[model samples]
Structure formats: structure tokens, C-alpha cells
Target chain A: MTTDALALPMAVPAAGLPARVRIHEVGARDGLQNEKATVPTEVKAEFVRRLADAGLTTIEATSFVRPEWVPQLADAERLYPLVAGLPVALPVLVPNERGLDRALRLGARRVAVFASATESFAKANLNRTVDEALAMFEPVVARAKAEGVHVRGYLSMCFGDPWEGPVPLPRVVRVCRALLDQGCDELSLGDTIGVATPGHVTALLAALEEAGVPVSALGVHFHDTYGQALANTLAALQHGVTTVDASAGGLGGCPYAKSATGNLATEDLVWMLRGLGIDTGVDLGRLVATSVWMAERLGRPSPSRTVRALAPTVASPASHKEQ
Target chain B: MTTDALALPMAVPAAGLPARVRIHEVGARDGLQNEKATVPTEVKAEFVRRLADAGLTTIEATSFVRPEWVPQLADAERLYPLVAGLPVALPVLVPNERGLDRALRLGARRVAVFASATESFAKANLNRTVDEALAMFEPVVARAKAEGVHVRGYLSMCFGDPWEGPVPLPRVVRVCRALLDQGCDELSLGDTIGVATPGHVTALLAALEEAGVPVSALGVHFHDTYGQALANTLAALQHGVTTVDASAGGLGGCPYAKSATGNLATEDLVWMLRGLGIDTGVDLGRLVATSVWMAERLGRPSPSRTVRALAPTVASPASHKEQ
Candidate 1:
């Protein structure tokens, strides 16, 4: 890449923003889970190691869901242990008691349970009602906490749902309270459909605060289906949310969502945070190189605008080494 | 498209934002200027008409520069008369007195002069020093004002320059003041290389305000090269600036910049504005259709994330009719 394209933005810190942001990297698990092809277990482990090398403190390693459910991430058993010895946090996804048992058996220290804020998504994604799904996650979270493991509750469809149009604020707040009450150490609100705007983001954070959920305990996971992810992220930062979930190379779309777009790209998030003078502890050059390498492994160009812009020479598969 | 994918974000107005935003549509001028393939004059005229039909009040029609400098927009004279009778305001770009004369000959009521904020960009883009370029625009702005015509001054490279790195705020403010002092009706601050962040945007606007420029007299023109345009636009909105410059369907790239990404997509901007309950009088569905049609003419998909998500089926050439 030319020096012009690789040059970082000038740092100018804004008011009412945190000095540091903890980026919850989700590329290895949430990103790979939606891929059609089966990535090798060794490749997944290297990807996590590369992410940790790029200075991301928390990287979601793999999902312990049943192999048939998300075959792309079926190698969780082999993947977690490979990256478990890293200095960074390796959080894995656990669907229920069975998944929790499998994860705990592998000596996993950090785990996240996925929940849905809307009824339609809960039924469509989990084949259960919202309450039933929460009932399933309650034990998983409680057990993890009892084991002194950090628990994260991922509340999906918090902004808009595909089957149900605009999700109500109270509906999302109730689910968030349920997750926190069941002992989730933190919560990641998911905009699965990516229909959220800045005002909706601000309003949701405010409502959650009014409902007794601390802003410090909340992280936002916004998809870029409508190109509102970074803008919504800025609103969350303005509201004192220091944790943001992003995927490397903008990988992983929601299989159930109508749009095929995925989570906010970590490279894009890092560019903004670095420009805002917020400490992310990320080496942008190294992070971009990692995404470029992963994009080659996927045999497709990255969906991230930042990745495409910063690493134009190596972004496409035909340009360099083949998978 | 499914209704779920076409769903609009819920209206949740935020505090400290303007009640309405006036979008300065530049697909025909700034957007088309960098095209390698020549779009037919008839297609350009129809694109402006479609943008007006989508409820954009101010549309920049074409630039009246020498044909050799920008062969893509060489049909400015032919394209201007075709869309001049529309109800919306059609502003054309003029690089100098000669270009301004050509525009005035066509009874143009609104014209814009493109200026550079940094010395390096001024030399590279205008072939003159910053002061020399300002001196050139002074006469052009005066002539337009004497004719009772509205003039917009575009200050490019206000945030970062390719050769100069991050531009100082005072340097940008000085150029903005110069443009206003020369009797320009409004100024559009251009992040030509798209390196701006929220804090930088806020800082630049505040600096301009300190230099006696009213927020009402300014517009923000952000590029999405680094995926920060919408966030920077949000910061501009939060600062109470109501005018935003966007390209229809995310057409146009800066041929001078290293990255090939273009302006912030109008559909993306409208999505955020509509969600914030700020009136821009745009119909999102119709706008997406217009962009899709223009993308077909360009023989490429639009760079806009919103256009891709909203009008997925029609954004590609193979799916529908051939140009």
C-alpha cells in the first residue's frame, strides 16, 4: 500500500468520550460461524493468535454449538485449546447447558450465551420462545459465574428484527435485565438486521440505563447492512459505552437475517478510535495485515471498507498467495 | 426485495440535533468527474431528474471546466439545459473565471468554486499556491455575487492532505474565511482523502465558529475511504450544521487521492437523517432506485452500502438489463 493510504488520521479527542475503548474481537467465532466452507482448526487458531498479536485484548475463539447447527465452527474443541495459552482473553460461545459443559471441559475461562430480544428472532434462531431461550441461558450463565468464569450475554435483535419490524425499547430492556439478573458479567446488544440509526442507539442506551443497567456493563454489536454501524458506535461511545464488538475483515453475517452483511469491521473501528485519540492498544498496520491475510484464506475480498482501502494490494486473492 | 430488508429505522430524535437537514446532491458533478468511462449526456440529465424526484432540493448539476481536464463532464453545456428547468436548485462547479463565464451564459443561478485548504493540494489540484488560488476565486465569487447568483466554496483537504498529512485547523479556517469574505454564499468543507474522525470534525467546526463563521453558513462533505464519513457527518449534525454533501448511489471517487472510494452515499445519509426524525424530504425507496439505475449506466455497482442493502437485486448489471 502507498504511504498516503496507510497514513493514520490526525488525533483530535472529542468531549464526553472515554479515553480508552476495549474492542471485543469476534472474527474467529461469530465471523467464521456463518461461512459456508469449513475453515481448518489450525487456521482458526492462528487467526486468534494473529488477533491477539494485533493488540485486541478479547477475541471470541469459537462456538460450542452442536456441529450440525453451525458446522463451520464445529471444531471448537480443537480451536479453543490452541489459543487458550495466549495472554489475551479468549471468549467462546455457549448455547446452553450442554455447550457450557463442553466449553468448561476444555478449561474455558470466558464464555458468552446468545439471547434474542425479539420473539420472532428467538423462535426462528433458537426454536424457542424468548422466555424459553432465556431459561436455557440462565443456567449456563449461572454455572459459568459459579465457576468464576466471566460471562457475557449477547442480546440479539435489540434494534430491529426481520420478521417483526421495529423492536420496542421496553422489550429489549426486559431481556437485558433478565440476562444481567441471571449473572451475565456484561451485555452486548446486537443489531442483527443493522437497521439502527444514531438516535435509536442513544435512546436504547438511555432506556437500558433507566432500567438499571449500567452503561459500563454494556457493549454494542452493530452490523453494517445499512452502513450505520460506525455512526451508531460513535453514539454508544458518547453514552459512555467503552466496549465495542467488531469482526476482523468484516466477516460473518447473520444466517437468519435478510441481509448478508456482517458485524462492524475491527479495522474500521480501530481507525475511528485511533483518530479520536482513544487508546485501543492496536497496531493498525499489523491489524490490517492480519485482515488481509485472513481474507486470502477465505478466498474472497474483505467486506471492510478500511481493509479494502488500506491493503488494496493484498486484499484480493488473485493478487498474491492462494489458500 | 423483502419488506424486512426494506424496513426503515424507527424515528427516535436525539437531543442537540437540527430539526431538518438540506442535502447538497453532487452525483452529477463531483461524483461523475472522476469516472474513467464516459456516461452519456442523456443519462446524466436523467440522473439529476431522478435525484430531484427523490426530493433533493439542491443538486449540483455539472462542472464547467475544460473538456481536456475532465472529459467525463465535458457535456456540461448540453447537460445543464436538460435539467435546468427542474423545480430544484441546480448548482454547477466553476474552476475559474472562464468556467464561471460558461456557466453564467447558460443562465445558471447557482455556482460553486472548488478551493484547496492546504498548499500542497492547492498546487496539485489547482496548479497554484493557496493564496494564488484564493485570488483566482475572489474574482469569480465577486462576479457571481454581482449577478445575484448563489455561490458555494468547496474547501478540499481540510482534514488531511496526501503529501502534507494532517492539516492544521487554523489553515482550514483561514481559507473558509477567505471564501466567505469573497462573498460566497456557503462553504462545503471537504475531507478529500477521507481521513477525518468525529473529534477532528468537531474541532474544525468549532475552529470555524471561533473565526466568526456561522454554523448555518457551512456544509460538510465527507468521503467514506476509511469508513468514517457517516460518523463524521453525525458529529457535524451534532454541532448544529444542517447542510450535508453526498453523492447519489455513492458515485464518484477522487482521482487525485490514493484510495478509490468516493463520497458518502446519499442513501446512507438519508437513512441516518430519517432515523433521527430530521426532515430531508427524501424518499429512501425512490432514491435507492435512482442510484441502482445510475449504477447500471456506470457499468458498476454503487459503492454505497445502503444502496447495496436496500436494492440488492437491481444493483448488479447481470441481474437486469444491459447498458
Candidate 2:
């Protein structure tokens, strides 16, 4: 385009700022946990290693839930040993003190406490009220913090709840405040059912700010069930939330969710960031190929549009649009 | 959200402004033209009537193309008569002078002309060069004008060509200008392969503006291939473009363009508009239900996320946080 064209009223800036955001790879834990087929522990470990090699700084290795609840991730013990000693930080999900005990015994340096913002969701998912769940996390956070392990708290269904209706912003703020007060170094607000619009993201973040939660203590996790995940993430990034949770190959769909939609694909996120001149250390081609490999292993096509669009065909890539 | 939290930045003004925009529903024409199964003419006529009932003033009815090429829409003759005398402005696509002759004989009051920006695509689809295709439209546009009929020009492959690589913005602007100069009342820019990004949309519209084409004279047509169609359309709306072209159920995908994805679903576009408080005069739930019907007829679920999420579940319109 000519310089005259770029000078239009809404001219796009070069956006030279580094996309220094950290992507916490969640495919290993959140992704495989929902799969019907159990991925081998060695395969899960290799997935983590590949993700780290692709320049991801953090990886949610595996959840320590009971085997009866999540048979796919039942071999977390075996998987944790193989992924140990990686340079990247590994955080595992702990539903309660028992799950925390498993991670702590396994030498976990970081652990995440999971809770939902809605009473119905919390009751259904964790089988406890919000207060009771927060109360249970008190011991888990204290133990992990005393052991010098960072504790990250997750508030799921913060935007919209399935059993109930629209979650009140005050309720979300209270949950965020509770998580912060309970010693979570950072809080990742999850649109667990992927019903969030950009406006919802902005409104929730604004309420959090008003509640005196520092922006630095926040991350955003989005599902792509409604196809607003990327747009919602952009809203969060603009609000200065630096950490994002994404599943590789967009592998995971929420077990509680009815739709077959995929999570936000890491390759697609990296592609958008790179286009904006954001510096995500993750290599796009390698990540795309790795995601394709994982999809092959799961006997499914990759859920990522970017991966599918970028994969080679009989026609050359150059034949496709450069944009 | 609190008052302070509610007041966020604005790129586009709320739709309550004095300016009234028009939405041209292309579901019946551009949408079904590419369907695998031939839609009965009665179904096509009923779909047009439903769209008109949904407050869509401009509904594209059918294309006067050869039955051998587009078998799905081969019964345009039968369908056009069914929608005749409707209060809505129903336009039909005319491929050439021969097609225009058929439309004129059928008393088509409003007609649309088509041209491609890329030579390869022009040759592949229309069996002509880019210049030849535009030249072919010159007579069609003239005949429509002489017959006191309104003419709209469709410039396909504006952002990227499926056969050739990147289509330069200058080339797209030139084609758009030529079509406008050919006595067409409006210009519709199509991302036929769905390769457009917001940056591309911004840059191209800016180029058109710099070329002295009134932004209000342009409409946007996007496909959801990269999942950026809505975002790209939002970027266009930020400019003064008042019209957008969309297919119901995300119905249109180019069969000639291998791996090309679905068009921007009318339901999805309506959802975004309603979220932004823009008045498209289209009923969200009814549009979604109609799209679901279309999808069922095709024996395929919709390619639109909004239709899939809203229909058969969301009983009421959710409140918009932005509003």
C-alpha cells in the first residue's frame, strides 16, 4: 500500500512492541485430561519437552487428580518424573490437599488451585461451595508457599456460568480478591465455557482493577467454543495481562461443555502475535508440526485453523495469500 | 460493572447515531450457489421471504448463471418468479451480457456484476483475464442502468487470490474504481478465499478512500477461513462503509478454490452488530433458526459459531456489556 493509503484515519501502527507475553502450555494437562484415549506417560513427557524446546517458559505438566476422575492423566506420577529437570516452570493442578500432597511429594515447584466463581459450577465441579473450596485451598496454598513453590489460582466460569445465568461482576471480583488474599502469586481468570465477548473481558478486568487487584497479578484463559477466544485475549493483552493459557493444536474441549470446539490453538495465537511484531519466543512452524503430530496420535485432525491453513498441500504455500 | 468500569475506549461510535446503514443479505444467492446439494426453488423462495420478514430490506435472490456450472442454483428462473413483487429489493447476479439478458427478460429490477482482481482466479472461475472479466461487466452494467435498474459490482479476491499469491492493494483499488466507473451504484469488496486480516482490510479500505471512492459506496464480503472475517468486518465498519454482505449458516464456500472456508455467517455478523448496539434490523434468534434450517437442509451443521451456540438453546437475547 502507498503511504497515502496508510495515512487513513484508522491507520494501523507498526506495533513494534515485543509480545513478551508468556504462554503457559496447557495441552498436556488440560488437553489430554479430556481425551477418551489415555496418552502414554512418555508421550506426554515428550510433548512437554517439545513445548519447552519451542521456547515456552511455562508448562502445566499434569493434573494430580484421582485416577477414577481422570484416567487419562492417572499416570501423572510416571509423567512427572520424565519431565522433571526441565528449564521451564511446571505447574500442576491441585483440586484439594490430597492432590497438593501428590504434587508436593513429586517436588513440584509450582502448583495451581482450581475453583469456579459460580456456586452451581463449584458445587458440580468441585462438589463444594465457593467458600468451602476456598477454605480447602488455604492449606494447599500455605503448604506450597512455605515450601517456596509459587501458587497460581484459577477462577473458572468467571464470565458466564452454565447452570446459572450471567455471573455478576461483583461475584467475579470477590473470587479474584479471595484468590489473591489466599496467597496466589497470580490469578488466571478462565472463561471455562468460552462464552466471553471482548466487552465481557474488558468489563471483568475493569471490575478486578476496581477491587484493587493489581494487573500484574492476572492472566487470562479462554476457550474457543464461541470463536471469541483470540479477540478476548487481545482485550486482555491490551489491559496488560501478560500470561495466557493455551492448548497446543487447540487440543482440549471442556469436559463439562457440550460443544466439540477446541481450545485456543497455540500456533494461531503465535501467528497473530508475530503479525503484530510481538516477540513470542515460540517457533510457529515447529509448534504447528508438533501439533499435527499430536493430532495424528489422537487420531483426529488438528483443531487449529492456522495449523490446517499452514500445512503443506500439493499446491505451494506461496500460491496462498501472503496476508 | 461499575460506572467507571463501563466507560471504555471507543473506536466506532454506538449504532444509535443518526446515520443509518444497510445490510445486504446474500444468503439466498451467494450462499446456496456453492452448496453441494441442489436446493429446491421453493425452499430458496421461502428463505428469501423469511429474510425479508426479518427486516432485511436488501435480499439477493438468485444468480442468472448456467445450470451446468452452478447446479445448486440452476432453478433461478423458478425462484425469481416466486420472489417477484416482494417489497424488498431483491437483486440477482448476472455473469455476462447473456446472463444480464436473462435477468432483464425476467424483469430483474436490481442486478449485480462480478469481476476478480487476480488474473489466475479470473481465468479459473470466469474463463477470462482480470481485465477481460471487468470488460465483460461493462456491457452488463450499462444495460442494467439503461433499463433503470440499480447495479452493484462485486470485486472478488480483493485481499488475496486463491491461485496467485498476494493481490496488491493497488490492483484491488483499480478494479473497484473501474467497476464504480462502469455505472455501478455500489461496490462490494470480497475476501473470497478468507485470507484477509484486519490490517489488510484497513489498508485496502484506506487505499480506496485515497483513490477518492466514497467509503459509503462500499460493502464488505468476507469468509471465515482464518476466523478473522468478523474482526476484519469490524475494522471496515470503523471506516464509513455502511453495507456488509453475509451468507446465512455461513453457507458459501468456493468449490473451485480448494480448501476455501465458509463465508461470514449472517447470524455471526448480526451477533456482533447486536453486541455493539448496531441496528442491522435483523432478528438474531430468527436468523439463527433460519440458518439452522438451512444447515439441516444441507445435511451439515453450520460453519458459523454463533448459529451453533445460540440456536436451540439461548431463549433470550443476552445483555450487552458494552451497552
Off by over 4 Å in 1: A1-6, A312-323, B1-6, B313-323
As a TM-score, model 1 comes out at: 0.97
Model 2 chain A weakest lDDT span, ten residues long: A1-10
> Which structure among the candidates has the greatest lDDT?
1
Instruction: Give the alpha carbon lDDT tens digit for every residue of B1-323 in model 2.
Output: 11111111121223222245578888898888777767788878888877887788899998888878888878888889889878999999899998898888888899998888888778878999889888899989988999899999988888777656558889998998899988999999998876666656777898999999998789999877656676667667766777989887788877766656778888766655654556678776667667776666678888787677665453232421111
Candidate 2 wrong stretches, greater than 4 Å: A1-18, A53-55, A311-323, B1-22, B53-55, B146-148, B310-323
Task: Report how far off residue B275 is in candidate 1 (Å).
Answer: 0.5
User: Which candidate wins on TM-score?
Assistant: 1
Candidate 2 CAPRI level: incorrect
